[model samples]
Target: MSRKPIIGKCRLCGEIKKLTFEHVPPETTFNNYSVRILSGEEVIKQVADPNNPPWDFSDTKGTIQQRGRGGYYLCGDCNSKTGQWYVPEYSKFVHIVHSALQEVKGKEFGALGIKMKGIKPLSIFKQIMTLFCDINEGMMGDNSLKDYLLNKTSTNFKRERYHLYMHIHSGSVERMNGIMVQFASGVGLITLSEISTYPVGFALYIDKPEAYNPEGVEITIFSQFNYDDEIELEIIIPKLESNIFFSGDYRTKEEIENAIQESKDN
Candidate 1:
């Protein structure tokens, strides 16, 4: 018989805490079954093509794929608190989308003229996104995140921007699709290149710098593997000089490396 994963000290408080399942992308975004099975299958197909199997498959079949562990162990209190904290903020995010769709015009394209305009949802979303990014980066031991708003901060903003870009460009209602796919499939790692191709309809610059120089803004991605564990990926995005913008998805590892190489070349 197989032994169950053990619950020991809480990652946050270090108490002898009870273990419960936690979803990195938030379970409210997708059906549990779809996240576990269908998304798992998709990842398998991507990584384990029979014609070009670079890695051994026998050991991977029964075990959960590396990418599929977006959801993992958590204590009840942490889980409940995360839900309560993000739900209202997520709802506000939806409202911002609604307002943007209703009021934003073509002439406003590529212009940073769009303001938050007392939209509490956008403000709250920004704050929560910042917090989530900080926690994830802290877990990864990246000591570069000093300014949350001015510098390249967190992966959550990148993911959120990717979703918003998709909704605007593809006319698709699957705003949370990429995040759901990552969470369900255990593929928390993504690069800038992958997201750049995600059919974004608007221009987005997350924590992009205000001026252009040799040391352009650096964009980084991070994710929670288990409740306490996390990972990071970095990419450098140039400062945008024009206003015409379109949004898309986040990048995968390969894509991120490709972007970094391209930046070096430039």
Candidate 2:
């Protein structure tokens, strides 16, 4: 006999219902098919076998290069609502970003830069915000995010209060989809920050005017953006801390080079 469908509260509406697969970054962004996987244990053994000896894990560990996986996380109603209202604009935006990677005439940083046009900022913002919600609710198992979203509501969601940060990155076969939820207490208030990575990287968090910014990190500007304005995103090499790493992003310089070579072969 087939197992009974699990009853759960909707991430978008908070209504109890049967759950559905909710692709976190939306399915269209998963166009890249190049595959590459690696094992940390294998690398550790390889590095340790020569210098330290007896740290071998190659027998137990290996790399992973497989087709991307989708998240099965949502209720039927929310899945339908988001598909109707948000996915179209999000699909367009992802296409533009990926197209910039695939084709470019002559421009500085052509290989790793993008120039986007005819963007609907509100739509894209909502789409990205939705991704944050999906990760927080579906993956991280938090249900409180409906304050900013949910059907049949004109929420007093303050766009400016929440900040969006995008990190431009190149795709590799090893790239994955993931999120990191962090709580930081500073500036007199505890802030909940959610960072997500897949086709791109983004940080969704609260920021107040003239607040004590202890993080010292400069997030990108995305709220209240003009829908018709042209926007350009460029990639730059920077030193990063391991704690803040976006699991879905390119991990290392070697991984970056391998991804470039794989792209050329394809």
Candidate 3:
């Protein structure tokens, strides 16, 4: 049965309208499969149990989303416009990276200089920002994002308030976290959100401190490109493994296992 139309505040544009499912990452970018969406607390409970093995989510508690990982956070007009304007180009860029990852499947962890050809960097970046908007509602609600996304040619996003980072992701879990504040060892307190799925992951830092040093390559420069300016460029993106449920956790499988064993030993 088709679900009834949901009425709510649109994440983008902040208008009260009929909401539609806005995929965090576009559906074509490997987000169409069935996934069990778990809350951060649920994941922490599992991960906190020292007896529970890593990557074993068979008995985990979560709502099984048959369609994909997304929610009705956008209205029809905003959804249609962003989907038409940004998804295609973003999907192409994701596929290019996916193909590159496949070629170097068993290789060691290192940076890859991918020579992406004929890509609309602005559209790709806007699509990523769209994902950020979808994930966050009241916390990161800035009208600048709506204006930046709605106007295809506008390059006036508030760069001082936001920074976008990307990394190649290979993990067993997909994540979509709302705005969270956490303290890093050297970085003190930082505010950020993360969306990590297959082949790619993105972290959006909100009001980042000068001392905050984040993993992955920053791509906030993509906002400067014009709408139709297709260009060839190479980006050196590092591969990071997200084997656990923690946001921005990039411990490898071997590293995770070793840590688990050490915990038991101690």
Query: Candidate 3, TM-score vs. the true structure?
Result: 0.92
- Residue-level lDDT of model 1, residues 110-134, one tens digit each, is 3222233333333233333433332
Ranking by lDDT: 3, 2, 1
Worst 10 residues of 2 by lDDT: 237-246
Sort by TM-score, best first. 3, 2, 1
Query: Where does candidate 2 stray beyond 4 Å?
Result: 1-4, 31-68, 104-114, 138-148, 151-155, 171-198, 207-266
User: Model 1: which ten-residue window has the lowest total lDDT?
Assistant: 191-200
What C-alpha lDDT, on a 0 to 100 scale, does residue 210 get in candidate 3? Answer: 90
Q: What TM-score, over all chains together, does every model reach?
A: 0.36, 0.57, 0.92
Model 2: per-residue lDDT, tens digit, 85-190? 6678778876775675455434435124444666555556667767666655552344444644453233344655565555544332222333434343554543
Q: Best TM-score goes to which candidate?
A: 3
lDDT of 2: 0.50
Q: Model 3 — which ten-residue stretch has the worst lDDT?
A: 137-146
The all-Cα superposition gives candidate 2 an RMSD in Å to the true structure of 9.0
